[model samples]
Target: MSSEKQNLKAGESHGQCQEKAEEWMQSTKDTANAAMDKTADATQSAKNAAPENKEQAAGFLQQTGEQVKGMAQGAVDTVKSTLGVGDKK
Candidate 1:
């Protein structure tokens, strides 16, 4: 092949490689952006669920407290009955 023709072909090959590199870079950037967006959405979802979790915990604690109170009252009544210190209902 002629030198000029060889050089032209080499230049075309370099251009094609450059184009491929740019395309790869653009694809990588898009993928990175999508990943970041998904992470942000997940973070926000967790943040949104936090209050609901807290409310549920509070409700559970309240229910547990009430149960404990009832048990204590029953124990007190039983003690009084055994000791004959108070009238049993």
Candidate 2:
């Protein structure tokens, strides 16, 4: 403990040390506030985009379902063709 105190005295004066500590703390606080602001902005953007994203996803799913139905119909038609079941021939 005494060595620590000696080291402190040997380097910066008490006022200088206090000033540096205050500056460091201020800088840390500024960085934290900026991060918090960015997080808040990101959260708000996600909230705003949620409905649009949901609508887009729903549309995509609907298209995929339609494609699947078309593919199934095509497969059934192919089988019928091979069996000569439905064609007028």
Candidate 3:
């Protein structure tokens, strides 16, 4: 082939390569953006769920505290009776 024809062919090949590269880059960017959006949604969901978990934990702690108080009061009453400090009935 003539030198001019060879140069034209080379230019066309370079343009095609550049177009494919740009498309690949765009596709990669879109995939990355979608993954980021999903991650953000998951993070927000976790944040929203935390308050309910905290409330459940607080309720459990309150029940535990009440139980402990009752046990302590019972022990105190028993100790007082053993020491001959019972209230007259």
Candidate 4:
């Protein structure tokens, strides 16, 4: 291929990569938001139920804790992935 054609192709490739990165970032943000919302709802439900049902309230609280832990783990994993350092495979 000619030098001009090669440069054009490289530019196109770079643009595509940028676009994909943007999409990935948006998706990550969306996922984080949804996780936070779920955590908030679970916490609220647990608090409201605590006055009415002990067992059910405990379950809700447990769910909320698990959600928080999962979110933390997700954040760690995302950071590792972005830095290209972490689990292999």
Report the lDDT of model 3 for residue 24. 100
The TM-score between candidate 1 and the true structure equals 0.66
Cα lDDT for residue 83, model 3?
95
Q: For candidate 3, write residues 1-89 as lDDT tens digits.
A: 69999999999999999999999999999999999999999999999999999999999999999999999999999999899897868
- Candidate with the larger TM-score of 2 and 3: 2
Judged by whole-model lDDT over C-alpha atoms, candidate 3 comes out at: 0.97
| Candidate 4 C-alpha lDDT tens digits along 33-85 | 99999999999998997777987788899999999999999999999999999
lDDT (Cα, tens digit) per residue for candidate 1, span 1-89: 69999999999999999999999999999999999999999999999999999999999999999999999999998998889989746
Candidate 1: residue 64 lDDT (0-100): 100
Candidate 2, superposed: residue stretches over 4 Å from native:
1-12, 86-89
How many clashing pairs per prediction, in order?
0, 0, 0, 0
Backbone clashes (count) for model 4: 0
TM-score of each: 0.66, 0.77, 0.61, 0.58
Model 3 spans with C-alpha error above 4 angstroms: 59-89
lDDT of each: 0.97, 0.95, 0.97, 0.96
lDDT of 2 by residue, 1-89 (tens): 99999998867787798899999999999999999999999999999999999999999999999999999999999999899889674
